[model samples]
Target: MLYRIFTDKEAFEEALYSYQTNLSIILAALLLMPFNYLMEVFKWQLSIKSLTYLPFKQATAGVLSGVSLGFVTPHAVGDYFAKIWSFSHEDRKKALGPILVARMSQMIPTLAFGAVAFIVFIQRKPVFDDYSSDYTSWLIPVAGLIAFLLLSFLFIKYGVKNKKWMYYFDLIRKLQLKSVAQLVALSSVRYFIFSVQFMLLLSIFSFPISFQQQFLGIAFMFLAKSVLPTFNFFNDLGIREFSAVLYFETFDISAAPVILASLLLWLINIALPALIGLFFVPQFKIDPS
Candidate 1:
């Protein structure tokens, strides 16, 4: 069973090991790490500050710890668990508020960018040329998506009037429009940085793609990956490589190198932070009492 579970991983490692890489590209990619991480730390610090005050340094620790917890658990729900544990007993109970807002805020950029990316790929890309899905054909689904989002917002907006649903989403009630807007802006900056990093890495590996098409691929791949829920970090391993291979192949990029690039990205962005998070885990204290 364990061997079967790891079969996909074995394939990924084999490809990653066999691929040649540019040292300059690796160094350039590494340079984005601190800035990328700092953005997340900044966003988290600001979000949590709305509920409980935390200095930047401590917030960094919490964010990393959350990263680790998120890494091991599906959808990183453990992120919330680790966060609340970091607080005192009394605060632990209330900590869910900020954590919930922080998480949803993080998704704002993904949703916004993902929506655009989906449209771009569906319309402009050659692969989608025969897809039979055109911009006008896009209206119904887009309208449905918009309606869904609006309904979710309306629930959050007016749920306060009804006690049954209000308490559960109470934190959302405190999330004023201005604050949500700020979170979206902050998240957008982070999303742009991460997208650039992915492109840099792809170029480093010599992905055969034009700049415009490359972004179209990136948008769809990132959007698709985020749209699905992963059972574990490794669960998305196949998804990332497959998505990259599919999109890049439209431009004649080979699969092996693309898979390797995706692996390196996972190592850089997810695995490294998760390893760092392990150190902060010891500091987590849960006080259910």
Candidate 2:
């Protein structure tokens, strides 16, 4: 992705010039990385508390390990195993429940905020004017609703009958309303941190949009990226750039800054943590016995 972007020599040069002058903004974005992941660690700590008491140090290590492994796997499925492996064999199955809860808590804000952003995005006549009459747009919502209902029916009728599946249902039942609310609150904080980091990176690149426009563009980009399917190899590479460019081009903003900001945000939030997590990766060992 970097190579592709750098191929456009003009964009590359502009980004470098921006970086040299806005060094402090770059530093600020980097500083937020710890707090972003720290929020995740706290979410992890709270999520697993229902099943086992994970100390702060161990939770931090486990969360980092999950990030490292998740970097290499589709949809970050490796994250679930990483957290589960942190427990004894006896507790591993139970751990799945909390791991899922932690994941869902994080996703709720993305979906909720993304839904609103999508609605607002479509209302922008400059972008959605042509698509206003398109039937395909209506098809997407109808299809989604049908699929959701079908899946819910199948899960209720068949999934609940499986003994192994009961673990997750039971775990959900065990969680109090307060704990669930706390998980959502912590996840919201993490989401806000990353969003601010993206905005900071944009400012560093001198994006010429108003604050509201920038926030809307960022929110829309995140929503599009989150809802789309991605293989692990391509997860952080192209989707974000495409989404940002697609949204901001309407405002006559240059693609260079938008693309660079998205890429830099990925580096600070995802790539950097994955590098730190490499240290803890070797410590995770699965027992076959």
Candidate 3:
């Protein structure tokens, strides 16, 4: 028998390798996109609550303007400025509040995923007996914590740092606690769902990795982005690929299929969102003066 002729170890490896070549996982990852899109809507909901009691249409416009700008500018700074400008047209201070909060919602899950992945990376390394002195890998979580604390302090102390409490400060106060908590919670939910996107890519290729491992893999990808903020052009493509390669090496995971999976996820996760922004030609009623 072929099974008897081949050693059991060899037989298992053959089965594993063969199993890794199927497409079921990619289909699963694709299912995550709608969840990601729905997560965006929650941000819209929070933004609406943070604004000047405007109807959903106006707040939606502000959200669209923010996203549209995020698409055009390097690193999505354009979206931040666009939101500020769009909201300022109605209530500059109030509009700025949610725009600020929206960013917090966006990053929480990114950092959370990265933190867990870093832990997994460390654990996964001893299995291979291949070690690198990049202890700086540990810095991602530390820096993220420091940065989050610093920003939170600033938002709490100086978000309305001026005495115009009635106009901006008080309104910002109303949003400060709830918005931050919601964004953080929402971001975590978003990350879990987004991992499904990655799973789909691997499923397409018949890769046999767990969703949790995929999450850690994807987390490391994002962590690498935070580690090197200056290589701004494709928003961490090289960093992401390098990180993926690093993780893949641990499982004796081949480079080609992993790279393929990473690239496909990137296309789905980033490029698609930017493309969606193109359809957001909003009509705002801000004065021409």
Give the best candidate by lDDT: 2
What TM-score do all the candidates reach, one by one?
0.80, 0.83, 0.69
**Model 3 lDDT tens row, 117-215:** 777687774312334544455566657764885477356545655566446444446666556677667767777676666655655444466666766
**In candidate 2, residue 130 scores what lDDT?**
50
Off by over 4 Å in 1: 1-21, 119-151, 161-165
* lDDT at position 146, candidate 3: 44
Better of 1 and 2 by TM-score: 2
1 against 2, candidate with superior lDDT:
2
Clashes of 2: 0
**What are the lDDT scores of the predictions, listed in order?**
0.67, 0.74, 0.60
Regions of candidate 2 where Cα sits further than 4 Å from its true position? 1-8, 125-162
Model 3 scores what on Cα lDDT?
0.60
Number of the top TM-score candidate = 2
Candidate 2 residue pairs in backbone clash: none
Report how far off residue 232 is in candidate 1 (Å).
2.1
